[model samples]
Target: MRIIHVAVIAMLVFAAAYVYRIKMESTVRTEKVLQLHAEVRKEREAIAQLRAEWAKLDAPGRLQGLAERHLKLKPINARQFDQLKNLPERPPSIVNPGDPDPIASMIEKIDPDIITGSLPVPEAAH
Candidate 1:
């Protein structure tokens, strides 16, 4: 009867130790999770700040100002516009009509069997 009592006490002690260890591990993990959440919040705030700066930098007026200052460009004038019909006719074709296409000759040099594999086609199922 005393032996049985001692065994029960030992088992209870072991269970208590296991529960304490699990509680400690859970507490550590909880702290790590909280730290990660804080880091994520900080990263989100940084991204918001960068987006605000990007909006300021990408404003159309700011871009036009930068282009005018750096590129020394001028705005379009009414005289600059021209009718498409006023454009000159395209120049004559460079290749002679008698000449065969160079690309076609290069393709003809390769074996047709190599392109469409040497494997026999399977018979069509009924």
Candidate 2:
């Protein structure tokens, strides 16, 4: 009877120790999760701040002011417009008329069957 009592007490002590260890592990993991959540929140706030700064910098009024200060540009007037017919004739084509199409030539070189239509085409899926 005494031996049975001692064995039961030992088993109870081991179970208590195991439960305490598990609890400690759970607490540590919960703290780590909270720390990660805080870091993510800080990162999101930083990103929001950066986006706000970017929006301020890219505002049309601010950009227009910067452009006017840095770049010497004039507003358009009717005199600046010109008819297309008044323009000079374009330069002549550089390629020779006798030359074959470059893409066709490349296709013929890579696979003569493609140009000849000798390969079997796959049917489209329904």
Candidate 3:
């Protein structure tokens, strides 16, 4: 009977120790979670501050002012353009008019059974 009492007391002590250890672990984890939350909040605040500074730096008025101060730019006028005859001749096209499109032929070659029908192509409005 005395040995059974000692065993029960030992079990009770072990259970108490286990519960204490679990409580301590939970407390430590809670503190770590709080620390992480603080870090995240601080990071968000820093990002907001950086964004505010970026807004100040990237303002259009400020950029235009800087450009006007440093860059010597003039507005475009009719005098800048040249006569149509003076301009270079247009480059020759890779595919001539009425010639089978090389791209379409290659795609047809990849799959012989592919319906190479006239797909509705968007034309440039003259």
Candidate 4:
């Protein structure tokens, strides 16, 4: 009877240790899940911040103001163009009308059967 009691006590102790180990492992897993969730939240916040900054930088009114302050530029008119008086004339084409078509010489140079007909393909030249 005393031996039976000792075995029962040992079994109870082992069962308690098993339950405690399982509880600790579940707690560790939950902590890891929370840490991953926090990291994802931080990344989402960074993306939102970057998008807001991009929106502000690309505003049209801000761009126009920057251009006016930095460039100090103006539009031109026909009055500015008319100020130029003595421009040179363009040269005429150098081709002579009496000359025959240049393509006729190239056609004479190339064999008609090579390009115009179904000829056997040659092997690699290299």
Off by over 4 Å in 3: 91-126
Worst 10 residues of 3 by lDDT: 105-114
Please say which candidate is ahead in lDDT: 2 or 4.
2
List RMSD in Å for every model shown: 13.6, 13.6, 13.3, 12.4
Report the lDDT tens digits of candidate 1 across residue range 1-126: 999999999999999999999999999999999999999999999999999999999999999889988997787999998999999999965555665795665566667656475868768999
| Ranked candidates, highest lDDT first | 1, 3, 2, 4
lDDT of 4 by residue, 34-90 (tens): 999999999999999999999999999999999999997997876766443566676
Give the C-alpha miss distance for residue 23 in model 3, angstroms. Answer: 0.5
lDDT of 2 by residue, 12-57 (tens): 9999999999999999999999999999999999999999999999
TM-score of 4: 0.55
List pairs with backbone clashes in candidate 3. Answer: none
Is candidate 1 or 3 superior in TM-score?
3
> How accurate locally, in lDDT, is each candidate?
0.89, 0.88, 0.89, 0.85
- What is candidate 2's local distance difference test score? 0.88
Best by TM-score: 2
Candidate 1 stretches with Cα past 4 Å from truth are 92-126
Show pairs that collide, candidate 4. Answer: none
Assess the local accuracy of residue 70 in candidate 1 as a C-alpha lDDT between 0 and 100.
Answer: 95
